[model samples]
Target: MAMVITVAIAVATELAIVGAGPAGMAAAEVAAGHGVEVTLVDEQAVPGGQFLRQPPPQFGVSDWLGDPVYREGRRLLERVSADRRLEWIMRSSVAGIFSNGDDDGDEPFTLVLNPVGEGDSGEGGAPRQLSARRVLIASGCFDLPVAFPGWTLPGVMAAGGIQAFVKSQQLVPGKRFLFAGSHPLQLVVADQIVQAGGSVAGVLFAQSSSRALALLKHPSVLLGNADKLSQTAGILWRLRRAGVPVRFRQTVLSANGTDSLESVTTVPVGPDGAIDSDAAEEIECDRLGVCFAFSTSSELARQAGVDCRWDASRGGWIAKHDDNMASSVPGVFVAGETTGVAGSDIAALEGQVAAIGCAAELGKIDARQAVELARLPRRQLSRRARFARLLSELAWPGASLFDQLMSDSATLCKCEGLTVGMLRTQLGRHPDIRTASAAKLLSRAGMGLCQGRYCHFALTRLMARQLGVPEERVGGFTSRFPAKPVSIGRLIGDDS
Candidate 1:
């Protein structure tokens, strides 16, 4: 005999905001202020997304990092918490999105929500449903994994992951660390490690400082984002003061260790963005922090049947959105990294724009009022987006990095244990395998717990290389429902 559990379902709201990141919080505040009943759902216990992630109250952690983003996030959380029209569903994830009705009429988007217990345990819980007239997806991004030898080692971690552990948990991953990746976030992480009394062996950036310096040519752009530039400068200054070696145009070629990361082999990138094989060098470190960049967490949007297009600079396969952040699907809006890889500032602005658009569509506000309310946010979003593009271009991983770094023995899909050589063998057996999805079917490369989030980008690049086509042409895999895994018992609730 099988056991069954019953859980009560909550009432539906006029608007539902998935993800409580800056974008979701901003959207909820805006919509609630306009007299719309808004419910914000997020997987984390705290409301802030990764940028504004808050430590548990019991942790007694203060804002020692002095990040303006976190300060702003705290303010946003307080304001959103105080909104009477808004409800927060914490530690809950959207299992799936089901839509009914046609675009001609008001469509109802149903969210299957799975609420986790303390410490995110999946045990002893039943799924619930929440329906909304309009849904706004503000799902943020995760670190893009770059595959190489020994990446599966225990001490190897994403740069963002390291930052989160250090900032939120006051935990140090390792004593000595090698930070190798693209983006300024790595530098910030390194500084955090140093402040926490850990050692940073060195910092290696795949892009050259010359390209970043060239941004100074655009004085107006820099002036407009003076605080951001200042923040970057401060992080770099701390790293310099700590005597951390910072090298540009360099990337990790391989990580080596017996059971955990012990050392990393790095190579300088050439002018054409290919690794200089002759210039390879090895550095000793206990841990390696690497992140190529970020990929948009657009799985929810994709599962909702919204159209997406390939944009490499924006971290690939971003959902299509109009000026108001409304997707092709009627009554569905997308904001933040779900639409693209723009950072938290642009995400907040886009969230406001999305809320206004959704409010007008839902009859909470007139079209004229919505337009007037959205004008400033739209302008601010455009300005922030332009700056974000500049940063993305600077941090964009080199095209040849994958081909140069990935070895035949390296594990490409860590979840499924599918390696580069195994993928090659599958391609050889099935020459018809041209896209990532087809490769997944032939080799089970992406059939894993993560559902190909970590390996899809690399797989796309690999397939493109195998087929002699562009990466975009190779494309990505189809996202299925229950964006995150859910238990069968939870799916089928108790009859009583």
Candidate 2:
């Protein structure tokens, strides 16, 4: 690294949105439209969120408006990019949000970012730091992957990640692939793989029609925008037309492979949601796709000291926000899946609503306008939340998922390489030490790798079940400085 000094300019960078996904980008555009200066930062080189992915050039689609949600998302990004007041900073991450000093005599957020190498980095080299008066967090959710035996195999990957790779880089892991998981994603990925010149061995669905029936009770999912339903049906039709085997009510109990994934042993569960031994079978395949679904992006909000609660129906821990998407912490706001998992449409609406609230806070927009813009999403949220809740209840991961976790195998901390037995031993005689901090004190599960992203939910679930406490009653993991992993060298920057 070399040393250099750049002039630091002070401007009206009123709001900083942390993700370029639909929600975050929408917040920036809407806020800027209301006369506020906004900065939208994302780790990706482009603005589309994971769901509204823009495939690589080799894929032959300049703009694939295959679905209605994607079409609208693309339009939104275009509008945001065209706006002069909205600054787009790609290839940067919001390491942490701090209110440490008076910049220009104004108390604003201090954001730390790191830039990576060429292709991976949004711009070019290392990350840079900036300041903003108001901060809006919309860092979208990441897929939750539960490790199975032999899951460490090279050919195994999360379905969402695989789809992202196919869309972003026009790359496929293998020719023959097996995608097994909850509905929508399972069929969607299976169809994409086939379209991408990959062979689908089989589609093992962990959900059944019984769950789908429950999913329909909520009217919002029923009144789903025409585009989403079309895409969902199209994927299902493609899988059926391709003659791909579809296995329902089955889940991967274990992955069997020496070097890579050679086979997957699946257990077919009965209507009662227990594995039926008689229906268990082994499926041979070179690639395996597994997903435990997705969790919220409440890490930043949690780190900012906002109040959070666990809503299993909404997917993991979510921030406690009002109708306006304002967090408990003043001058801070949250939107999209980070608040809860309600799919893309709802996330977009929430993002827009958050922007309106932000405008009101900055005196750029009136409360009446904010209220009017927020109504549709509130109604949609109320209408479909029940059904989402039902589906979540039905799709809840069973306690058996972790029952057999090898005591000596990697546990609490995936990045730091901590193990379960080590964590258990650290608790010593404190039998009631069940919080994330307690687990961290014992074995550093939430302290390494993702800084609690991967293990936080699992740990909370396990502790709640073990102690017979309600999930909502359980507290969340506490984070420290450098909310994300940071290098000492980067902190010192050119001064080094």
Candidate 3:
């Protein structure tokens, strides 16, 4: 059940921070230390974001993330939850943020909040609107949707989604699991499943072991992230002891089953990135967990008129920010993976810098003090940035390379039930279709219940290549207000 928060929004706050993960939590800590009044909101019921997602207080759950690997996150959560200065509005989402057209910079933004889950009474959002002098968007990222053969099967799931089930719900959704992808995230999720006493068929990587090792052996990666490296090594050791096979240069060709996944076809990829279908191996597993990359949740920022750019290696359509993490628009700031797909450590540092920047902007602190506070976090961020670049290279598997995995009969838009051939026919019918929005209207690809989040990545790749343009030129779906779906009952509910 959602936590129905009773918000009294009679007055405006000096700063409003969205997301309660590392970035949002860390920012609130700094804001409190600097004596700034903050309204910290999160879509989750708890403080932890995706990386440190914790179960609700009433779940009677404990010690899920208590492992040594998550020590830093645990410490941060403890500090932030104990902070009384920060006001929280949890289990709710920001529908839209509108800037006052006038030049009055003081409290110039209005935020519309709507209750989520079944607990909401479906009243039209009126009294829920709140005012803020500044806004920090730290909305995180989600799994990169890969539309391949039989990807929409009932038993197929994103690797991160599987991890969430085990971590928060303490329930393994499937008995047997097969993980396949380019990034090491699959390895981590597989280890979690194994620890949860779930059967694992195997873990496959598209890249060779040598290439991944050389990147891990980088001096910067080794020195700056010793804890992270240690945790990864521990997870690998556990997986090996559990008798889980970890293979290299291997990828999933397709998932075959009647109604749900009963088996998966695995194919070996050569050093030149060529798939060897003649030596395909069939692995029986009830679940297929695929982790290619991540897609940032920057729709709210974009809807607020913030500028964003695409970098397929990182989370796509990321908000552009300056040294202080301030967005191009005045009085609006962003941090964490929404800025890019860096890890939580880098996100926390960026959050501190953004908080101090906000304090300076709102006159709670002097310019010199803000610089002094941000200097250390900025220095730490630069060191982490070097390692993040190396990881990006490993995470990025060009969309064209997916041709070997996805077949023409594969469903492109699960929401619309549109197949790859259907989309291709639409593209072929209209040679001038270049942008994603055009492709959406022309082919009806991203028009569905998911609002294109699931299909947009795949659609952008197809449209960009067909039109001979970059994904950036293809542009993302037009970020509309009410970024999340609201019920018609709520829309017409009496404001009184």
Per-prediction tally of clashes: 0, 6, 0
Report how far residue 21 has shifted in candidate 3, in Å.
Answer: 0.7
Q: How many backbone clashes does candidate 3 have?
A: 0
lDDT of model 1 at residue 491? 57
lDDT of 3 by residue, 354-423 (tens): 9999999888899999889899999999988877867777766656567666568888899889988899
Q: 431, model 3: CA deviation in Å?
A: 0.9
Model 3 residue 201 CA deviation in Å: 0.9
The full ranking of all candidates by lDDT, starting with the best, is 3, 1, 2
Highest-lDDT candidate: 3
Q: Whole-model lDDT, candidate 2? A: 0.68
TM-score versus the correct structure, for each prediction: 0.93, 0.87, 0.93
Better of 1 and 3 by lDDT: 3
**Model 2 per-residue lDDT tens digits across residues 431-486:** 77867677666666787647888777666766676667876665777766556665
Report the C-alpha lDDT of model 1 over 1-496, residue by residue, as the tens digit. Answer: 4643334675688899999988999999888888888999999887788877677757876554466635666788788867777788888888777786655544388888888662233455677788788999999888888888888888899998998888778899898999998766777789889989999999887877787455423322211223455666676788888899988888898889888887898999987888887889999999899967788887888889888887766777898989889998878899988887877777888899999998898888998999899999988877778776876776777657777788788899999998888888888888888888888888888788788888888788887888899887887788887788776655565322
Location of the lowest summed lDDT over 10 successive residues in candidate 2? 218-227
RMSD of 2: 4.0
| CA displacement after TM-score superposition, residue 304 of candidate 3 (Å) | 1.2
